[model samples]
Target: MFPKTHLTIAAGATVLVAATVLMSPSSNVEAKRMSYALDLEQGSVSAPAKGPASADEQNSGEVKTDTASSSAPTSGEKGQTEATVAAAPSEPALDWQAFEIKSGDTLSSLFKAAGFNDGIMLSVIHGEGDADKLQRLYAGETIRFASDDQGKLAAVELQRNRLKSLKVSRTDDGFKGQILTREPEARPMFASGVIDDSLYASARAAGLNDKLTMELTDIFGWDVDFVYDVRKGDRFEVVYQDLYLDGKKLGTGKILSARFINRGDERLALLYTDDAGNSDYFTPDGKSMRKAILRTPIDARVSSPFNLQRRHPVLGVVRPHEGTDYAAAPGTPIKAAGSGRVISAGRKGGYGRAVVLQHGDGITTLYAHMSRIARGMKAGSRVKQGQTIGYVGSSGLATGPHLHYEYRVNGRPVNSRTVKLPDAKPVPSSEMAQFRKVADQRLAQFNVFEGREQQLAMAEEE
Candidate 1:
């Protein structure tokens, strides 16, 4: 618009007026033509148009200058003058707009906010593949909308996480969906900590998360009694996997190796997976780190020991207390001591809400006084070792929230504690060599990290 078309016409008109004057008695028309040309070059002639002025020109109170048309040829030059205007190239238009999902926002509401109706939203939701996942949008996620020139929905993108997303695009008949994913880079990491007060505090100080801390306890739970044996000076070292994407940390994976020092005894657990895809922790000598049963199922102190002549606190008389009582907070999970099948999972006379597991060699374990049994845990259901079977609660004849754990051999109640637990099967002879090689390598890594830590400590002391 700044290159005004009116200027070209005005210049031609000036030439025409000059020629008409030359044909008259005025012989100075040539001089007038040159004067008009000079005026045109200096932009002295005002160009008047019928249309209202543009906002820019009106606000500034100035006329728009068209440099290209300012030097336009006059009508007297040759037959006439014509200007060839070139078309400008167009730029690509952006059609996508992104919106962050907030709490309580549904797919319908999001579509409406993106300027779409329920019909379009339903079309997207019913698209092929993972398009239905849009209905399960979570807070802190992102959703993008792409529209056509007519402002109709063209495509929809749902960013679920850094590693995964779903995109749905409009097609002739309906919508088409496709899922996208990215793989994270896995790297080895090392951490070591000396317990000052508790395991959780020390592990956190050493940069271990809650999941890794719990996993560490589980790896060594069979050998060391974490509830009573962990002391102030007990230390731990772990080599684990840290996942990353484009140099940014995502989360942690699995622990490769861990060493725990409890009560002046060192226990090492190295993770190894066989060719058959079976994975478990093993000692340096190829012995399985697992036992026939866990030392204690719940993370709590023993309130009552198994005694044949102990007086019952609730009965107020001398009664044979056969099971050991573990006192924990209400609703604390009680894990299975070993893999077994449930023989009974109901209320007993004195023990309310009890579950008895049938094991090999005529061994059976009993868990009594639960707030409630875990789902899928019923009679004849098989359970794995360390699986949660019930919660801690004083169900029937009890004083407070506690678990009465009994380990019976051939229907005879035995002391749950002080009884030597049988060892689990060791590494298969076919894979012993492979396990030893992996264990040695992982243990070497642990040693290297330990040496580096010790050196740093000594340097700091000096």
Candidate 2:
């Protein structure tokens, strides 16, 4: 009996040693079994297993993580999991479609092409806040839209340009729209060039766009005759605003100051705004750069001049030509020579379609032979100076397309080309101090740019 008991005891001790070895900390299976829960939900661990608190938990008063657990995430794995959750988008993904606006494309047609009906489009068009701007859609713009799973229009965006857009979204009440605009960073820019062939050619060589070139001419048009006075040595210096978006040039802004040298005579114009928000170009001594009326309303050469004893081109008789005739292409815009009220707008005997404006100081101007009158130009309607009243056309008894312009003072016909134009009002006495401040600043900027350009030219010459 004693021998049998000894053998049984020895076998039990061996089995106990095998169990301890399987459960040891060094064993891979044991380490996995003792792992902590890596996933946490709602800022807490659910159904946590009771264990001794780690040093971290003891100091921070937080739940302890089972470091011995094989399922516990490593530092890298923990970071990755947290990042993924953070990176998850809050809104659902959408499939957007883009459509480019072409010529003659209407909103209805674009909506139909995008698999939508006119009803949806009308709703978007009738949306709030600048939604009416969509009615005047321009070519080369883009439109993007998205729909829900139910095929209902969810959102629409009109990309007018790179920096301007309009976005409309679906709401319970109705579609709401908001104009989105990105302000471009404005940087001062300068350009200078001497005229050899023409103002446009020299301006283009100096990196000035057609718009800026025209503006430069208009700034000095009151004092200089660009059509006849510009010489080969005439030069121009412009300090303007260059707009940029994301380090790329978007376009140009206003001309801050400009200097034009015409026929060896230099004229400078500085832009200024008064306390009442009236903005105009002015000379250094506070003289208005604008004249009461334009010397020549249109930018065309004089085909016929005002004369008292001249032979008529069509009638073949010696008659008094009271007005000057400008030769231009058909459909060229004719401008209002000065701010005035239209005394007459319609056919008048020898004059085809004519518009006569009655101005202050008993001055009257007439533009005859127009293809069509601009909208809002009618008898008793007021017009601003430089506003387009009609397009060039041979409406009256004429040989070809031309504008017969007449300017009169006190009911007496005068030579529109040779008559001295009256000057506009100068800077108000109350605003002279403010005007001087702005003038000085603009002049300083202009001078600095001019100096820089001269240095550059000298360096190139060397």
Q: Please name the candidate that would achieve the greatest lDDT relative to the true structure.
A: 2
lDDT, residue 41, model 2: 15
Over 1-462, each residue of candidate 2 has an lDDT whose tens digit, in order, gives: 569989999999888778645544542333244333333212333445555556764566543236553244568987998899776643445557899999999989988888899888888889887766677788999998887757778888899999989988888988888899999999999999999999999999999999999999889989888888789999898999999999999999989999898878888999998887877899999999999999988989999999999999889999999999999999999999999899999998899999999999899999998988899988999999999999999998889999999999999999987888899999999988988999999999998998898899899999
TM-score of each: 0.73, 0.73
Task: Assess candidate 1 and give its TM-score to the true structure.
Answer: 0.73
Please list the Cα RMSD from the true structure of every candidate, rounded to 1 decimal place.
17.0, 11.1
Residue-by-residue lDDT tens digits, candidate 1, 94-171: 378889999999888888898998998998989887788778888999999988767878889999999999889877
Candidate 2 global TM-score = 0.73
The 0-to-1 C-alpha lDDT of every candidate, in the order given, reads: 0.85, 0.87
Steric collisions counted per model: 0, 4
Clashing pairs in 1: none
